[model samples]
Target: MNAKELHDKTPDQLREELSNLKKESFNLRFQQATGQLENPAQIKIARRAAARVKTVLNQKAAAAAATE
Candidate 1:
């Protein structure tokens, strides 16, 4: 997903997306181990996507905390 899309998601949704991305990453790794992965680049993509979600989530949390 793109940054714009990620930023648009609410905190709860972002967390859910993060969970799904991590699971996908794990599955990709398993596929790689078994030599069944059609695309090795998927691992990197999933990792970066997860990181983007996390970065945005943190940003939102900090912004909320700062207002208080």
Candidate 2:
């Protein structure tokens, strides 16, 4: 997911996306721990996606606060 796409979503949608990303990250870690993971790169990808979502959320919050 790109930051531009995330920026288009409302905060509520972004939160849900973040939740899903975190869950995926957890599952990826579990798979890696079990030696069942085909690609360890997935773990890093999920983490970065979650961070992107978080960054967008923070930017939205800051923009809202600035306007108030």
**Predicted structure with the largest TM-score when compared to the true one:** 2
- How far is 66's C-alpha from truth in model 1 (Å)? 0.7
Backbone clash pairs for candidate 2 read: none
- Over 1-68, each residue of candidate 2 has an lDDT whose tens digit, in order, gives 89989999999999999999999999999999999999999999999999999999999999999999
RMSD of each candidate relative to the true structure: 0.6, 0.4
Sum up the clashes in candidate 1: 0
Best by lDDT: 2
lDDT per model, in order?
A: 0.95, 0.96
lDDT of 1: 0.95
The list of candidate 1 runs beyond 4 A from truth reads none
